[model samples]
Target: MSALTKQSAEEWTQLFDERYKRTAWPYGSAVWGKKEWVCPDLRNESVVSMDEGGSNLFWAERFGRELGMNDLWVKLCGNSHTGSFKDLGMTVLVSVVRQIIADGGTIRAVACASTGDTSASLAAYAAAGGIPAIVLLPRGKVSTAQLLQPIANGALVLALDTDFDGCMAVVQRLSLDEGIYLANSMNSLRLEGQKTVAIEIVQQLDWNVPDVVIIPGGNLGNVSALGAGFEMMASLGLIKKQPQIVVAQAEAANPLFRAYQRDWHFEPIEANPTQASAIQIGNPVSVRKAIRTLERHQGIVEQASESELADAAARADRTGMYNCPHTGVALAALIKLRKRGLIDARSRVVVVSTASGLKFTDFKLGYHEQRLPEVNALHTNAPVELPNDYDSVRRAIDTHSGWNP
Candidate 1:
């Protein structure tokens, strides 16, 4: 474990050059690209993966133009096997569990408390590796699509009556048993996998680091993971600079944002329900790691209200990107930062889309139908009813779309 932390710039660079150039998958996986840096002790056969990572670092030219930033990009982490960035971390966590079992460790099942994505990813990877998994979820909190992932993967899903924090506490206590292992972001192994997003971003940009990177914050693990990735890159001579990171949060559940507002005097909050359900974590387990990341990287924490996040997601969808509400939080934060002059319109930026928009169809439908409470649908493209006639259809199209015939 110390080897991962104590690796010098020269040693890291050597490993990067050797493995990063591989054409085969798993080796080509950004998380495993520098396998020596990630899980070096595991043999090829011991590795369990769905070829996660290598997600598209898409150039959001239209959306960038709208924001007056020509170099804006979206790291589409939603494109993973589990349809969320959680797959990146879960692959690593579950892989390590498999390696441990192979090495004579006695673990019967892996368990985690999830908002949605974590359990989905964990269950899928554990199933792939022939490992049984137990998932704890906040009852009626997670999206239907998210809840289905773990269930479909054959995990023992337990829907706790309390919120995610309660679920976390239960899972943590359950993992105390020697037969079960915890697969949460608190585990440093997951950070090693999540950090590869940073490596992949720089790699996709031909080794040119971006000026700013914004990611949604719930657990705060990703913030620290990204920071760790950049630190490792700089330490390994891969890059000369680190990006100014922004951890975007939903105002309804923004403990880290509130901490930043108080000049780093941190206090956890009782997170309220929000449309960005995936990040509705009040007391994040990785708050300390996130704070350390902020201190080291000159980080910024920004919060987006429900309406702002909804509007931002809708606006981004118009530009050909179907964004999850969590991604909306990051985009809203980007807008807020731009207004505050923290992020210049001219700077190259990347906003991480944590999960697929398809997972939140109900939220999207409610927004377009003007049904969600407290959210003003500023750009609704609602379907107009029409009679089944050419004239009626033409008139509805002309009226709704504002195109004169």
Candidate 2:
């Protein structure tokens, strides 16, 4: 099937109304709420869900004010069951695989190549559906927390001595066999589920569309997924206008950004190590689809330096948000656009935070400690170390609070 189909406005309106009123298990899911829009053929019993989606769209009042934008919002996709946006897609992919197997299909296991979040979400959902999960990961590239998830979920995790691109190649070859079902975003089914992020955003805003939407780009699947969502809504008259989409990338690993700069022509460069490990992709699988979406939306691709991303994450963290490094990359791009008047102060914008900061605790800790290389700790709030003496502790407190000792 194509990325998305255009539905009649009347048909969509009826479906939207039905979705809003649904209070059942799978239908209650924000992703599955628009079941007819996503995939309506699957039986409810075949669905495997942890009631994912319905993440908050928080008004970043302080952060927005700092940027002179009054209507900036952050989509907290990290607040899901698996602590990442991958949960939105994984549930659909695994559920469909289970259904196919239940109908006497010859699939033996579901497999995927992941950086971190995908493996975690895929493992959890596959485990829930009683399906064997096989995950291929770049060895020592993923964080401890991210690697631990698949291990805990009983996935057959293979750590290969290569980058994400290498792992992806191996998985693609393995999935050629009918016995191994592919669970990667290269499969349109996963993109179908991930597109719900865009749908849920409009629903949260009373069906009003924002002026701009910024997302972190990795495998490029999300770029197309988001575009598909808005296109579907526009086709159905659910939204009158389409937002200017932006794909943000870390400077160290920015193949899409390089292509955008050269008028969509470039050879893939070797991806450098970035703190945002999830987006460290040299050759993204969905590049062509992402390019199409970008052209359709007049999209912008921006890169954020290591210091820029780290500083942006640190600054956003101060405003009661523990943003992942990937979010920092997007936030930094938004900041650049706003500064250059590409994104005006009056426009309503939503920046998608892909994963939870908890997954990259070491990255956060290194930044706070002023330890990460090339990252400017613009707002460090390191804890004070005091000796084991009442007087010393009192003096340290007094010094910190500006009290004359």
Candidate 3:
């Protein structure tokens, strides 16, 4: 740590950029590319990586035009091995566990309670490291794709008849047993990798900071991790300005947003079910860390209704972007903030897309079919059925396209 502080910001930037360009074993992986900043003491062979991080920071040209903004972007963190931002953190957690075990520590298995993405990421990384993994999930809450990933990876998945908070309780208890190591975000090792997203965002933008960064919050660890990245950069003189951090939440499960409304007084609620299942957490373990980070940066917490999020996602999907429900929450918040004039038209803004839309096919199908509860389905597009005739097909196509004969 002291060695890193001795180097100037420009030196660190050059080093990171050079490492990013290399195709070496661990340097090719973004997390390990910044190993000195991440897990400095861990041996190179002990690291577990899947080339996580370095996700695309896409320019939302058409979407920005629709939002009346000229400088809007979406950081697609889901474009990774496990198809979510969780891959970034899980790599670090599992690598540290592998290192501990290799050093003669008696860790028999790694365990976590997840709504979906976390379990999938942990399972995949643990499997990659040849370590046993156990995941506790809230029964009937997670998407089918999310559940299948852990199962396919051979993780001991327990579907408890409870919500995410309940499952978290059980996992916490299991971690008390000496043999089972906890792999949740509450473990700071996860944040070491997750924080790399912030660095990557700045790096992708040529070391320029945006005016605002909005991320969908559930467990709240990611937001804090985001802050940690910026804080580290600032401490090292990499950046002089800090962007306003915004946290978007599903209104049904918005404990943080509620706390923000109440002058930062926090209280856990019984989280109601929402389509953004990955963020369906009510009592987030990192709430204190999140609040502290938010207090440091000029932070705001906003929430989206089910209708708002679904409509926002479908609306953005029209612009060639596939968004998960969690991303929809952030998009909806952006729309609201834009409408309220809190966000300027010329300000550069980036919305963090937490998970892949492919993982939530059911949500997409439910929206288009107009089946999801509380969603208005304003942008729903259903397939048109035509008879097996050329004239009939032509007529249907003409009608749909509003073509004149």
Candidate 4:
């Protein structure tokens, strides 16, 4: 369902703003875009996000004063049903799954590999939708909030003694299992839902599009899907200009950076070490798509160092953005590119903050700028107001955070 299928512009506009507020959604069976939407076959396969009002405010360039739609406008894909941009994909996938079940399908479960947000979205949805969800989380990777979703939603949460790659291995194995469905990037239905971000972005801009879109690269599905969205938008006459896309990655695992530099195929990486754990992927599932999309639209890939990411994370905190290390990496990359004159200052830039920093509840994005405390003084609750002499401070110290051990 797309704009052309609409009886009037007003009706299409209403559907475009569905994420802006909750109301009786009547466009369930109607086609609103150039693609067929899908959701899990639960009680109703038509459920969608009821976006609060003012998503339009974000769409409008408050960064500008006149309120006129410039050549570009920012789209907060993060405003999806699940809080993170994954909702854009999950909503549609849920609908599709529900619909398939209604048709006497034998689908038994859904599974995915998540750094944090995607697993939560799937768990919450599958739990609410009465579908069994199997979430494979990397060992010692995600935060408590990230890990809580599956347990809270009553899904089978498997703490893989592995990283995202290992979890992905399990997902691929499950996908091969009879009656098991993998919800990872392998499912194309999610992309249909994700395409709405671009569609709505153009609609919000009053149809003005960007010259470039920057994404924090991990599995790289979103970045690749973004290019797909723009191409479809162009075909549907949703936007006027095609934006060159750019990807940001941690220098610790600069596979994309290396690939771009050598003008060769992006080989799988072996080890990626960065504070930006969310985007720490040695082998992204959608690299081919990412490469193809970049070729079609002429995008660039860049890397950001850990120190730079930490500094930017602190800067975001200072500016009230309070982003996670993933976003920090993107911001750092952008700043570096700007300093190097790689990104034109006048070019409209959109950086995707995939997950919130608060998701990490315990871990922090930025590092200490000053010299770190000594081994005996790392406790947060340890007293630092001791006498000037280091010996006096040691003598006056209480137990470590009240831990007798």
Name the lDDT value of residue 193 in candidate 3: 94
TM-score of model 2 vs. true structure: 0.95
lDDT of each: 0.89, 0.90, 0.94, 0.64
Please, what is the TM-score per model? 0.94, 0.95, 0.98, 0.79
lDDT of 2 by residue, 348-404 (tens): 999999999999999999998999988878777788887789999888877785221
Most TM-score-accurate candidate? 3
Which prediction has more favorable TM-score, 2 or 3? Answer: 3
* Of 1 and 3, the candidate ranking higher by lDDT: 3
- Steric overlap count per candidate: 0, 0, 0, 24
Model 4, 329-385: lDDT tens per residue?
Answer: 776776777778776756766666666666754435214323322111121232356
Please report the TM-score between candidate 3 and the true structure.
0.98
Ranking, TM-score, top scorer first: 3, 2, 1, 4
Q: In model 4, where do residues sit more than 4 Å from their true spots?
A: 1-22, 26-81, 365-405
Please list the residue runs of candidate 3 whose C-alpha ends up more than 4 Å from where it truly belongs after superposition.
Answer: 401-405
Model 1, span 210-276: residue lDDT tens = 9999999998999999999899788767799999999999999999999998988888788899999
Candidates in descending lDDT order? 3, 2, 1, 4
